[model samples]
Target: MFELLKQPWHWAVSGTLIGLIVPLLLILGNKKFGISSSFRHICASCFPGNVKFFKYEWKKEIWNLFFVGGIIIGAFIATVFLTDPANSIRIAPDTAGILNSYGITDFSSLMPVQLFNWSNLFSIKGLVFFVIGGFLVGFGTRYAGGCTSGHSIMGLANLQKASLIATLFFMAGGFFSTNILIPLIFKYLQ
Candidate 1:
């Protein structure tokens, strides 16, 4: 059972579970499935000051907090218990060669130490990858009114036009970043 858990499952297995969540949440209590709004709930619950945005009755959405908590707990369990020490990332030869060209040969962990370690945190590469990228993601999530899972999964599941638009933009942005922005950053910034 532990060996099975350590092995990568078929994408369809998890995809089906994720797909089921929309109807399950709706069936349970007409609850919307989203992770981004939990941040607002945390702000409201912790700092209920004069911030008009977080002034709502966030207690009504307390279940969302529990849902997010479950995700965190699940991650901890998977990382500490389910992970196989011998298993390493398996990249395609061509992909690995391209990455090697970019001076990112370390494939021992999920993130390459060259780009993700504390020593590189203050460097231009790290700043662009972590700080700038994080800010853009946060800003995009706020501006779009939801994160990728919220808009692409829950919103689209509900047949929302706004969500369809948001998901399209999300795909386009991802393509642009992967094909253009990332290469430029690695080449010029690194």
Candidate 2:
């Protein structure tokens, strides 16, 4: 069982599990599913009197907080225990060549240490990637009324029109950022 946990599962297995979550949540009278809404729930529960946005009955969504907590704990456990140092990240030679062209040679870790290291955090490139990019993600999530998981999974499962539009834009933004913005940033900033 432990060895099985360490190995990568098939995509269909993961996809089926994720797909089951939608109907399960719906049957349980909870339509929403995503990490972003937990922030709103936290704000509503903690600072109800401070903002109108935080004045809702957040207790109804308390399960989401636990779900987020589980995700964090699971990630920590996987990183610390399940990970194999020898087989950490395996990028294809073609993909590695493309990444190398963008000044990212380190494929030893899940993320490029050259880009995500503590020393880089204080650099201009790091500020743009971490700080500015983080701010944009936060703003975009709020603007879109949810994150990719929420819009793409739950909303689409419920057949909501707004979710379809949001998912389309999300795909477009992802494509543009990956193809154009990230390359430009790597070319000039790094």
- Residue by residue across 8-126, what tens digits does model 1's lDDT show? 66789879988998889889999888888887788889987898988998989999999999999998898888878688667789878888978999988777888888887889987
> Model 2, which residues run further than 4 Å from truth?
27-31, 45-51
TM-score of 1: 0.87
What's the TM-score of every candidate structure? 0.87, 0.86
User: How many clashing residue pairs, candidate 2?
Assistant: 0
Q: Write the per-residue lDDT of candidate 2 for residues 1-190, one digit (tens) a residue.
A: 8877677667899899888987787788756677788878876887677778788878888889988898999889989888777767677998899889988888888888888878888898889878998888877988899987798988898898999999999999999998899888888875
lDDT of 1: 0.87
* Top candidate by lDDT: 1
Clashing pairs in 1: none
